[model samples]
Target: MPGLYLIPTPIAEPFVLPEYLKEIRCFVVENLREARRFLKWNFKDLDIDACLFLEINKNALDINEIHVFMKNAMAQNSDVGLLSDAGVPCVADPGAVVVEKAHELGFTVHPLVGPSSLLLALMASGFNGQCFAFHGYLPIPENEQIKKIKSLEEESSKRDMSQLFIETPYRNTKILQQLLATLNPATRLCVACDLGAATQEIISKKVRDWKPEKYNFHKRPAVFLIYAR
Candidate 1:
């Protein structure tokens, strides 16, 4: 295939779908080890050598690196599958740069619609999903990050909008703490965790309702929801 395959994978459980075996010839993912493990378990019948592996993080992959991937993509008429470490290919995760590049190269890019933690969290958030904005990860500096959060809060409150974002898995607790500290107690907050996984959780409460007694957010990826009055 001249273009790329923007393949969508499950949020947490990759082995859930058996059809993943027949989906694409090669997987151009961030991690090949995990991919192999999941595939061997899910589709053990599939030939291992038939799959070509590529490891390129979205943040680290530059245009030149992308060109190499595209060139490899053109080698065979076989399709190239692009997946993230989690969730859908292009939502909050990697694959946007390659997708855009494939389009610029006049390749027919196909997106395999599947599980997206983003949309799942939003729908289950119980927020006003009709008006929502997904501000992926915020800036690194605390000041700029706070500014982005404030802007989202202001917009959500003024227009009754819903602001959605995710944090690094390890720093999830810290982001929750920041949200609790910065967001007004009166503001409505929702925490959606482990979507489509074995130990999934979703909670809707105000910032003021946070309880140190029962809340324990350690080593879990979560979606933060903020809505202005």
Candidate 2:
């Protein structure tokens, strides 16, 4: 029987993909262009030009159509690879629908090992990984954002659980300011940026210790975590 391969793509260097994930060709990707580049760069021996590509993104998610596509592919005993733009799929990406269907249809779902910014940040942040919560993106509005930050901080302090979250790369600085302004001075904040890359930096310091003028993450992929004391 055909299986659904949940392949993890490199978070930074395309050449870093695992050797075991090089065989699969029929792919359901978050972005066709990036997937193509990744395959060509990572697996130079394969003919990426002849590969199959099915896009499953937030803007165009026809669940029924995708369900049919995977079902037909599975019927032929041809494995379908699901690749996320970055990190793992279905964890902040849009492959959950197809993965759930695969399980319901009695098809095997194989999860291959790869790097995840969320996990990498948590592991390196020196926070409470056992009871942590991953909040993908914080609120955008001023008042609501403040309220949410305070609530997350409170929960982190009371439960001794870390709070992990991300921000749109462009809005990263703005969010950092909010964290500095809202979170308690004693709260430890971990700003992990450029994970899995040479320029990666993971700084864990109290809110009062962070200097807004000294740091800039304008368009860098970053993960933020908080552990209240």
Candidate 3:
């Protein structure tokens, strides 16, 4: 039977590809260049040119294109692989549309085990794992971002739930500073940077103890988690 495989690519160094993925020839990727690099690095023996690569536009997702892609693959009895630029597909990624289309078309969806920065950060956060919310990205504006931070902290304190969010690599320091300044002194904050890489760093401290000058997360992918009780 034809299937839709949701493959998770490595967020950083040290790539690991599953043995079964060798058989898949059709792939739906977020970025064709990055996906090609990933396949070349991990699947050294595989002929990348022979495989089919379909790039998905992150800014504008077309439902009709996805429908045709899946329908044709299913009709030809060819398994299709869905890959994100990094981490798991369909989670914090635009690949969800493809997965939804696959489900609607009755294609078997298989999710493989792989590294996820969010889950990794949560595990190392030492916060409430049972009740947590992942807010993808905070507001970009200073005042609005500060307001959002305060509200998230308030929600965490009232519900005893952990609040997780991410920021762009270049703006990591700015967000960190805002978080430190806006959150209450007693609120706990965890910053996990460059997860699953050699330069990985995980720091958990209270708002009062976070020394901005001592750390630099600039230009490095990071996850921020806050919890207040």
Q: Of the candidates shown, which would achieve the greatest lDDT relative to the real structure?
A: 3
TM-score of each: 0.85, 0.93, 0.95
Error of 3 at 194 (Å): 0.8
Taking the tens digit of each residue's C-alpha lDDT, what string does model 2 give over 119-179?
9999999999889999889889999999999999999999999999999999998999989
Q: By summed lDDT, which 10 consecutive residues of candidate 2 come out lowest?
A: 13-22
lDDT accuracy of residue 221 in candidate 2:
95
Candidate RMSDs in order: 2.6, 1.7, 1.3
Ranking by lDDT: 3, 2, 1
Per-residue CA lDDT of model 1 for 82-177, tens digit only, reads 777676677787778777877776678877667887788889888898999888887768888788878888889999989998887788777777
Better of 1 and 2 by TM-score: 2
Deviation of model 1 at 141, angstroms: 4.6
Clashing pairs in 2: none
Better of 2 and 3 by TM-score: 3
Clashing pairs in 3: none
- The weakest ten consecutive residues by lDDT in model 3 span 57-66
Better of 2 and 3 by lDDT: 3
